[model samples]
Target: MKIEVNITKEPTKEPISFEIVDMSKKKYSEVKIYIPKKKGRKSVAPGDKWYVYFYWRDPETGKMNIKCKYYRGINQKKTVAEREEVAKAYQRSYQMLLEQGWNPLKNKIKNQRSSPKKQKHTLKSAIEYALAIKIRNTKESTARDYKFRSQFFLDWADVNFKSGLPLEQFKLEDFYQFMDYLELDYINKASGERLSNTSIDNTRRVISALFTELKNKRLIDTNFVKGIPKLKSEPLKNRPFTHSQLIEIKKYLEEHDPYLIQFISFLLYPILRPIEITRLKVRDLNTEDWILGVETKTEAFSYRKIITKMQPIIGQMELKGYPGSYSLFTNENKPSIWLPKQEKSKVNHFTNRFKKVKKALGYGKEYGLYSFRHTAIGDLYNSKQAEGIPEQQIIYDLMPITRHKSEAGLRNYLRNIKIALPADHSDIYTIDF
Candidate 1:
């Protein structure tokens, strides 16, 4: 926390026999000094020579911060006394900046606004920037989650402004109010229900992330969503599809929509999530052993081994000309494979088709596309058990193939199945021979 202060003579045109040189390198927590810049020497007043500079690391960015104040010194031709007064006025300006959280000793503006402010950020632009970085770094599934949450925030924030709200002037309470609006005013477009605390909290997180990045880039004055607690939320209860229901749905799809049958077949056997299934390309499937390298949520090759059951579906799909450059499951008319990072259209088409099929089957919203994966998990669990696989063994074998993060996710998937272990009661009853 030690900051050494010293004043060095400015480089002047008048040559001096001896120059005062301080050759010392030291780290500082804070430093207050004059800004050095070459001035035009056309008989300018000393008052105009008064220049103040502040340098520090930004609180949000932790990067070296720099700001300069060009105060109008007493008009050009000023006496020594006037120059002294101007110097004192600039000194006062520097002190005021220090008072407002500029820690020269630490070389960082403590509260983050002491530095020169950047251009005001529009809500849409800020969100798009963050989303671009998120999409670039993460899997499409995670990007979709961020995008999903960000939309609600933009919708809630931009209700009053058509262009976009400026993030610079936002207060901490504005975020709180945003959460309140999410709870009361915002409606879930999918379900037509008031936004839940969980959903609102998720939106809050996305905004916090946006602010964090914006502040890092010095785009915003402060981190608006920082330190806000997440609202408590109730966990969702999922209903796994039953075997009879699956059979009925399958028969319906087989008869009416061969495309959907192939699509669902890919989802059910390997128990791939909708996003992973959407990433499946025809060339990704190995014709020899059918080791379909799946692009899962966490790791691309987590589900490297395609199940023996899925091979038949792949064959059926192949027979229909699932070319190397096309997606494994496509619309009735197979579109070309979504190249590297573009999956928006693929997801949209897949979701719309799933919705239609689910509606046609008269299934509730709860039993949507993801339920196929859920049902697949249940089927795998039961079939493995029936074949005398140990409980832990079944979970182990399925974890890599299903790409579940842990045994806990697998257990959670089975929570809806109402499974009960069969125990031998003969020991307690003392069976007679």
Candidate 2:
């Protein structure tokens, strides 16, 4: 391989010129350019000659080799000092490469042995490249999630990734290490709680999706997480309020803080998830039919839930002058406005207030905001039993209203409701019909 330099002066800059040329065709796959730093020297004139060197890989043994190449301006002549400076710069570069253990002659011999190709993958470079490819095709939210997980992976894992690391190098042990980190990391933004099994499971799902993409790209031969087990989570449970408990909560809120009444009603009757109920708009309500159209976060089409019992409350909200804007729940003091928009905090505040209200009403610490939703489902289940409806029918009705993904999820919700119900009621196992 031969080293060559072609110099071109910038139109407005002094002393700094760019040297452009293909070095060893076998050493580097792409063209290389060397930009000289202006070390307080006057700019080169047109037709000046500058000396440069290029490095190439030997075809036989894949070692680096160097040769000299020179550049001359088409219309100007160069002073002896300018030529000397260029040669000195080349010498410095060559010395630096030699210090790094690159043997120019050995590379030339190595290049002769086989066709020149890009170097093999390092772990870091492969991961970076793979993530970049994923970012381009995925949603902004998905990309953000990948970026978050990748940051943690980079911090904990040792991989030589510049552009990206190869997926094939990732192991199941790495996945387990990541899970352990997540589980042991005690800091949580929400509630300042330790990392729970649920949170770790969510992280695992995202990572699994990321590796799945790498597999699809043929970057990895197998899913590195294939055999990794997830941390065990507790069974699904719902905390529901009893009938007397509900009345007491209503009385307390009505006397002390009326602002939360509408929000509570939205939760209690129609059984809307807090997120869905908060985002509801006035236009989503069908006044005559008592149906509230709920736009879920995961689904595209709007699903309707009947809140016929709350028609008067909905009418009162309209009379208060909150028209078809974004949020349905609003503070009574400012009827025209939705709940204060510090999302996560606002939800937390609501839950905390519910706990306080439950305590005041003598319901103990077990009742919570979610207790309302569970209570509604429990009510429906008991009503069905009273009306001679079978367990399957109760489950079927609860499915759409609860928006549970599977029958088992609905059943679990029901089981939790049963556990929370009053123990002394003799009709616990009896069907009235």
Candidate 3:
């Protein structure tokens, strides 16, 4: 049987008040015991379900929103009459609450505030939550890296700590122990090689970034990852290709794999990293305006001019009727739909494809796909120097093309690549003699 809960007020100028009445016909005054209809061998029971239903005005939308409160615990009563008594008690409580300005929405906030334990997050959940936020703010490749790194850490934690460790309870000492594990004990399952200092540091950086986000969200008291120092990484192994090596590689790519050469052009001309090139959409290119839109890791979008050298290559693409959503580079090295899951694989595909070219040319690990961009930047820097441009002016001019935000960053990159070297040191030796 259905129960009615009517809350009415006095007939005076003030709202008439009545705690309880029979008004089940009115939509807002219905409390009911729900029973599922028997189907096949299943039996229906009185205590199967119970609900208190009413209407409350939504503060934000100014619309009447239906609110429901379910009390399955009422079924704990032994008999039908006892369950009905408990249900009636619950209805009176709900009626009392509604009369005192208790909103289902607002009461939720009140309960959360009154009970801080509801906000507690376990170590695994905290990272998962942080990752959910991080993925939205970063590129797909970067998000993949974050997810892989975060999962690796979680797997490590599963082995070391008891399951479901609360985030706040994870101490700085625990983080240091994890770092030690990465440096000393961690092994690559695919290759069976121990993690290098650089690899360990990379893990640390990703975890630190995730923890930083967790702290900003107040999920944790502190980012213990920051307390641990970075391990000493190995020396830079990837160097820019020499001028002669560049010509050789280009010639090899053009002769053997012409499609791959176009990928190189985008990297060199736009100074895009391999992963960034994977992010390009067909619509990002504007042939008439001679501009290419690049979604960089740091910025949402940036424009790069399509220079005269790049114009011919863009024309060769023949990008006329292809959908704007199509990827500029794909498996066949042409424009097509690039699925989000396929973005990282496409990068690895191009990289592995380039490795074949590298093998054909007898190139070492130091020289790979990124060498094209590095070589182009070095050539540009040297070309400006040959024009007798000032070092400061050259840095200022290179900033936009290189997509470096500051002159110092560009200078640091040039210095690291050893492009800004002393010219004709023999003059100094002769003068000293």
List lDDT for all candidates, in order. Answer: 0.61, 0.58, 0.73
Q: lDDT for model 2, on a 0 to 1 scale?
A: 0.58
TM-score to true structure, per model: 0.58, 0.58, 0.70
> Model 2, residue 41: what's the lDDT?
48
Off by over 4 Å in 2: 1-155, 158-165, 183-194, 235-238, 331-349, 352-367, 415-433
Between candidates 2 and 3, name the one with more favorable lDDT: 3
Residue-level lDDT of model 1, residues 1-433, one tens digit each, is: 4344555555697554543333242212232434323463322334335444555445455555545444333333133333333444445444544544445555543333334353344666666555544444454445557767777667766775632666555677667777777777767589889877766777778778877876776777678587887777653533567878888888887777768777777777766777677777767777687677777666646436666767776666544464676766655445364443345566677778767777888876666677777667777777788777788898898877666789998777566444423334466886687
lDDT: the better of candidates 1 and 2: 1
**Number of the top lDDT candidate:** 3
Residue by residue across 25-111, what tens digits does model 3's lDDT show? 333444444433456421226535544456665545545566666563555543333444445545555554455445576466346
* Pairs clashing within candidate 3: 8-18, 9-16, 9-17, 10-16, 10-17
Candidate 3 deviant stretches above 4 angstroms: 1-118, 235-237, 321-323, 425-433
Query: What's the C-alpha lDDT at position 116 in model 2?
Result: 14
TM-score of 2: 0.58
Clashes of each: 9, 43, 5
Q: Which ten residues in a row have the lowest lDDT in candidate 3?
A: 35-44
lDDT per residue (tens digit) for residues 175-205 in model 2: 6766766788546677787766766776677
